[model samples]
Target chain A: MDLPSRIVITEEGPREGFQIEPGPITTADKIALIDALSVTGLSQIQVASFVNPKHVPGWADAELVVAGFAPRVGVSYTALWFNDSGLQRALAFRGKLTLAGFISLSASEPFALRNLNRDRAGQIEAMQNYARLHWQAGVPIAKIIVMAAFGCNFGGDVPAAKVVETVSDGLSIAREAGIEVREVSLADSMGWATPRRVAAAVGAVRDRWEDLRIALHLHDTRGQGIACAYEGLRLGVTAFDAAVAGLGGCPFAGQPGAPGNIATEELALLCEEMGIATGLDIEALIEAGRLAERIVGRRLPSAALRSGTLASLRRKVGP
Target chain B: MDLPSRIVITEEGPREGFQIEPGPITTADKIALIDALSVTGLSQIQVASFVNPKHVPGWADAELVVAGFAPRVGVSYTALWFNDSGLQRALAFRGKLTLAGFISLSASEPFALRNLNRDRAGQIEAMQNYARLHWQAGVPIAKIIVMAAFGCNFGGDVPAAKVVETVSDGLSIAREAGIEVREVSLADSMGWATPRRVAAAVGAVRDRWEDLRIALHLHDTRGQGIACAYEGLRLGVTAFDAAVAGLGGCPFAGQPGAPGNIATEELALLCEEMGIATGLDIEALIEAGRLAERIVGRRLPSAALRSGTLASLRRKVGP
Candidate 1:
């Protein structure tokens, strides 16, 4: 019941969806969705991922998408990049986007090996070099991201200790580079997180680093995303990473056609209904979800987009 | 968190799915689904709905479905009906099914008007007749169903008082019929339930009648069904009604393509993950969900079915 009065959502639909979708989704369409999400009172939006086009052909037009979309005044636009080459591309648009480096590590070693082609030591070495590059380029390492924080397809149930160890690895890398990170995003990359697992992982992380603000990057792959979000809220975790219309899928999780991220429209509804202000328009978010569906030329996994928000229903029903 | 040690799941996939599908679904397909659900360690299954063939042509073969499926030992198979004709139809299969009448009333009058064509007063009168018929036919009015107990499309926000009043009205009808109903099921008929609203309605009913067992009939229309169910679980509510693979939709809710009940597989996962025994085989349930998708000739709304179960993941990862 210790729900936060307000929660911050990082809109990841554009970045996540376009990266995994098997599409020649026009550059204009990608810009259109990001522009649509920009007006929904979202404080932050991940507009594109600067990954190699050979790996993810969907995000090939990343530069066009970033340069094309209209960025709002209050919204902090962000982008995802793994290596220095990707980072340099993102750094090209410094003012247009809020650039920060992430010490991203996978909680499960097997998951890291499959997705990143790196073992535990190899991942740490990569991040150590990544941290130094960010330092030399003067980009702040804002957070430590532990992928597969809950469980994994390759390694199965990830103990909270594994998450802590991952974070510790990230922290050591940050320390070597003389950088301080305050936030940690626990990602359910394989969609294996339940509420109980969320509680355990969040609790374990908090027990180790009491001052580090926690963020959940949950997937709806098994449909427990919102419930897991609810559990996080109960624990007073304020930051979440979500996709509008549930845009993103784990390309490396070995689950195809399973849902991607939790829907931002539904998560916002869950918050607003419980009297927790999301500071976003529910109707507008639903419309954006519909727009996302149209862009992808298929219905996304979000049921809320179909049923609509309660605000509209209340208006129809009257007082 | 006073979670129930064990919970009961009533598999309503056959009845709920077949009723709403615009299907020329064969009677054989329907029985095959029921038979699949029977071996999944479920204790109760709602096999079919006996309604007018002219209105709901999908369930025209309800008689054949009930007669066709091989009932497993220790499993209680049930059927739904609104009037005496439907009840008489169910009575035809006395030994084949567990026959119990439900005093189903809508908490919202306008919702009742749209769905049942009965106002608050008219609904009471109809249920009075319903109870008497069940008594005469040797069927116990086992529970009072409060539909739209959280909120409704036609009727805005249903207050806790309204739900209590609906339950009170049902109790009076049962008392008049000399029936002692022990259970009250609060249904999110149009999927307007949040955890807070569930707590309110569930608390209101329990405050008035602490002795009665509470059951939740949650729909995943807006994707908050599992979260609401988690809230119910925390409140020690033990019984849930679910559709395998999220097979049903509200035909009268003015919502097209919206998901119906929460998928039984996901709900069972939620319970089992929380250490609440559901006595359900998670793997078998996932298989049933897939079978449901195949029978419907389309992908159902359940993400868990596609992702499979954690038990499989554990096995894959090994101990």
Candidate 2:
């Protein structure tokens, strides 16, 4: 296996999980979860999503969560937003939150239609507006995130060509706004990705733009997230986004269709066990997962949270 | 990927789930689960374990369950046993079950000592008697199962050399009884397997015995089972053992150390979606997974059961 020696993981559990959970998960609980995650040696932690409170009541306290959490040294905190309003809300905490821009696009047209209620042209027009606003705010466009890059819940199978096409759309938007994007995150938003899809999408994107770095934001919707992540490691793609205890996806069958992202501790286990460094404290991450589960008032989907890190087991076996 | 054109899956949910669940789950529920599984186009199903009732009260009604279910014509039903008494009980249902024998050993000696309370010499001696008894009873020993083949909770990381050595022990016992073993099942009983370990172990064993058919029994303990299975597929392995709704493992972290095996439908999805034939009806198998979850009266860990197959979504996209 030609695996990268060290990889960077972007913790998206706080943003992804709290947004979907039905609970009015308290601002304090959200803050606590973020604070717990901050000490786990993660470099990037997306603490909350700045969105319309009416649409996402769960994240209505996004500002409170952002202000309450005690950010750790060397940890870069970030948040999610889709438009100028959300970006302005994020701008309130300039230094506390590291601000960056993203040109987000859906790889599947049907997904774009169903999710954002926009056609190709309308979607491009909207993103052009989004990129310009961020540039006006002096937030450098960090990367292009291609949602449904592998497959979609509404739009059956997404071929490799479609992913490449989708990336082109984001790049076009960035170009129109005079923004330079250096990375791409192929996201499996609905869990339609198999390892083959991950390989094809990553391969196709890289073939088109050799110098662009690739990251994976995988969902364990169909239980293949870890495998997809494994394939990413084999391809020497190092950046990843995971949820602690698999927060942010659907909790079970018959929910909202999309399930959890791959668990942070589990991914760390996969990487560290294979001699690849994730620079995470598996024990602390598992603790954070349990804390997230408790605050959500339900079990989360992470198997690692239940079985825990092998460190304790290894101790039992001795050196 | 040198993927297989087709693969065979052995369904072990009925036996694996019931044994661990803290339930006096009625014989009817067990029988119903087995019957439901029979229609999912699976060729093999392990229905029950004829163990001492006092030890595994879950399978105490094994006799009743064995007699109760209506088996499908094309499906082969099997059962598990360790001693002469359990074998005799299984023998009583000879016509109902397709009986086969196995030489089961743990690759980790510490695991053997901890799980079975037996040392290496003690385990081999016990297996020798067991194999001789099975041979006399006319039950062909089908395979040698190396448990904790990749890693173990009790023994930490199990080297590939140790796995080869453990398989050698099983073969030695088989040779003593003049029983020819043509297959080997590398089992990650405690969910300690990673893709690299899977590759090393499979490679080592195949190097020693070129003609032996290799099968994988994986656990999703640290959420690496599917990825390991993907690696197995890359190595051209064509046989696997899985649980419906990811049965027969630990449910949560503070529980037993081991968790579920790879979910059956998810494995089927991995194969079928990749254009590999699994001879499984993905929908029917999902329905079966739901039934297993209902019988167990808890949420299972299968993401496919929740998100469902892409067939429904495909219908939305015109051919």
Among all candidates shown, the one with the greatest TM-score: 1
Candidate 1 lDDT, tens digit per residue, A126-150?
9999999999999999799999999
lDDT of 1 at B4: 86
Worst 10 residues of 2 chain A by lDDT: A250-259
True contacts kept of 2: 0.83
Model 1 CA deviation exceeding 4 Å by range: none
DockQ of each: 0.84, 0.70
Clashing pairs in 2: A17-A248, A249-A259, A250-A259, A253-B306, A306-B252, A306-B253, B249-B259, B250-B258, B250-B259
Clashes of each: 0, 9
lDDT, residue B133, candidate 2: 92
lDDT of 1 by residue, B1-32 (tens): 67889999999999998988888899999998
B1-319 per-residue lDDT for model 2 (tens digits) = 7799999999999998998898879999999889988989999999999999888889999999999999889889999999999999999999899998889998888877976898888889989999999989999898999988987777788899999999999999999999999999999878888999999999999999999999999988878999999999999999999998889883322356346889999999999888889999988988988988888788888888888887766776656
What lDDT tens digits, residue by residue, belong to model 2 across residues A94-170? Answer: 99999986888887777789768987888889899999998888898889999888766666788999889989988
Give the range of the ten consecutive residues with the poorest summed lDDT in model 2 chain B: B250-259
Specify the poorest-scoring 10-residue window by lDDT in model 1 chain A. A16-25
